[model samples]
Target: MIEHTALVVGGTSGIGLATARLLQQRGATVHVVGRTERKLDPELIPHWADGGDPAQIAAVVAKAGPIDWLVVSLSGGEGAGPIAGLDVATLRRAFDAKFWAHLTTVRAALPHLTPTGSITLIGAISARAAMPGTAGLAAINGAVEALVKPLAAELAPIRVNGVSPGLVDTPWWSGFPAEARAAYFAQMAERLPTRRVATAEDVAEVVALAATNPNLTATVIEADGGARLAALV
Candidate 1:
């Protein structure tokens, strides 16, 4: 029985798609929006819009009507680079795709969100891990994660949380040639305590918990396979 409705922006692929599928399986009516449309399960409703655009997001949220959960998993383009050579434009784009998009979605959906509903923001391990080459990404994701506590307090009764994922096997790495991507994943896996990269479904499980568990709020759950701890050590 579908007991709730979820709006998953960026839900066309990767962590977003996996989350949508998981929520559907758990009996929630799921509506997904992405910059582009992809073939998805018939049960998953699809919408197309640029997450960076507030108007587009507003339209989608309006169409979704009332929602019990709003999951923002939009990805900005690549922003990783050394501090000395980092591109300002890339950092801005990243913020637009992630931080601003998250805020805009929340704003547009606030009226439609159930008072006891939840909002889960998807971030990355780079935010908390002091990784040398990830300064740009770290700033972008850090800003997103920083919103959890304040939003949770201000939006009381309406939960707000975040999920920071480590390196995962998803299309987000498709830019790397197949062999190089494999080698990189292997190297990172060896460094992680888990000795393996997480699957999209693995992170989705954490997202599901954050979105559905009323007792949890003002929390930023790390699903990064201990990458932050390993980085500190």
Candidate 2:
């Protein structure tokens, strides 16, 4: 039914789920891997595996068969407070989800990835700019960028890159009260040159590009609604 296969880690929701849908729409057989099973079309093979666990990742990859694309879109421990206030366990949890999980996924999927296959790592705009309560996220995202270049070189024909998105509309925001969400979006809208927050679909488009575009490798294509440029100006 599908022409290619893509394993979307963290694909049960948010940007990852959107990406899985997009890829499926484009004729790829997509396997959605996450901590929980969810309601999705039958074509999307749902597999339960916490990205933070290496063994789980290995098992998922084994079931997915040969992967033409791998997308890592996991997240953890948001709003853990300032660095000085964050306890050891919180920091470790954050790292386990974003940094180590990414490492494990890439390591496990590399063997099965096709020569021309590609990987798209999700990062945050906070990695480039400073934010008070997101120290762990920034640190891990920077590490992801650091890993991208070396991994790209090591993987050669298998491209490795990242997509750093600004505040996008996702379920993560649903936890906040309506007032808080509006204020947050308003503040970001004022600061960003584009004067609007990015949509998950906007970010997914870039991820799709990173996964299928042959010319790009070891690059962090930013889809942050011009936040980076605005900060400089």
Candidate 3:
């Protein structure tokens, strides 16, 4: 059991919250930080700050005190369309949310990280999968994955890893119409070799593994239900 403190930025919902719960189960004291309005758990301590803002993230790092683990799980922009039609505003917002947030949070939290601490960034399968309408997301995910190596090297013993998930059933898809969302999930389930979409718990398990494993650093763990293999078939 991990008997240390962990901070999960963007932990109010979705994968972030799931990872927090998992870490808590493993015996870590979890402090959750949400950028905007969020329903916080009573059992876990709460901190509020925008992940994209360095000042805000630094404040959260200070408020949380020392941390043995830090997970950055900010979601991407919602307005992604085709590359030609995608506006600069949308792309900028996506970058701020997905890319800047991870960097800013890590920069702020690095000082407070314990000697054996781990840092896990939530990435996406878009980094590898060549799907339509994910141009912006793919770029952001790629950046997150790219940082693993340099970050791990710079942080030394503090491991830096990523959990790249594909088509997880999370609130990220809840904005779509119920029927459409269900259909999309079904389509992905049929296409993936695993015959099912990922759950938040599925990604969370990998996040936990990355955080605890001594030998793992600068690695991007793919939790995509064999999407790559399915794409070939």
Candidate 4:
């Protein structure tokens, strides 16, 4: 937890918010940006901006001043469904919201990043997992993970990494009714080696590691609860 300044896009809630709080706890000056406003700690400098908009992202970066860690953890529109019934428009929206937004933010923050800083992109286990319904998510998140290797090589000295998380008890599943969500977690928990789902804090710890560890680059750490390894049934 070396002292550093960090900017976390999509930090208003969920994994992004958790990461921001964890960094702040470790004594990093953290600034957060999201499309909507939310109550945040006084120490966390907050801004509102759409991650998909280059202009807005540039403005947020400019306001944050030079940053040592740039983390992109925004959620795109849902693209999970069987290919036979898939809507191409949903996949396109997912890319627009996540993949392009990640690139846009990185490009905007480059000028303001510290020479020896780091950038962490948050993808999902769907990228590498053979989960059948997640084809669209795989494409979107896989593209994000793909950026790590090449970007790390090109951005040497300035580290670049990614985090691919599996199912966590985050708000992302809020669309499900409480009873249903709980049932879903219980079912998945039984199949996972850890016998539990991940917490947002659990995933945040990995993001913090990816951002602060100078030794790690071109790495994509999986924070799933062995969801990838378990049978997808």
lDDT of 3 by residue, 134-205 (tens): 787888889988999898998898999999998789888877999999988888798998999888898899
Residue-wise C-alpha lDDT for candidate 4, range 16-74, written one tens digit per residue = 99999999988999999999889998889999999889999999999996999999998
For 146-210, candidate 2 gives per-residue lDDT tens digits of 78888899888899999999889898788889999998888879888889888888889999999
What is each predicted model's overall lDDT from 0 to 1?
Answer: 0.91, 0.85, 0.86, 0.92
Superior candidate under TM-score, 2 versus 4 = 4
- Which predicted model would earn the best TM-score? 4
Among these predicted structures, which one has the highest lDDT? Answer: 4
Flag the better candidate by lDDT, 2 or 3.
3
Clashing pairs in 4: none
lDDT for predicted candidate 4 compared with the true structure: 0.92
Runs in model 1 with CA error above 4 Å? 231-233
TM-score rank order: 4, 1, 3, 2
- Kindly indicate the candidate among 1 and 3 with the higher lDDT: 1
Instruction: Point out the worst 10-residue segment of candidate 2 by lDDT.
Output: 74-83
Task: List candidate 2 segments past 4 Å from native.
Answer: 231-233
Where is model 4 more than 4 Å wrong at Cα? 1-3
Candidate 2 vs 3: which has more TM-score: 3
Winner on lDDT between 3 and 4 is 4
For model 3, name the residue pairs that clash: none
Among all windows of 10 consecutive residues in model 1, the one with the lowest summed lDDT is: 224-233
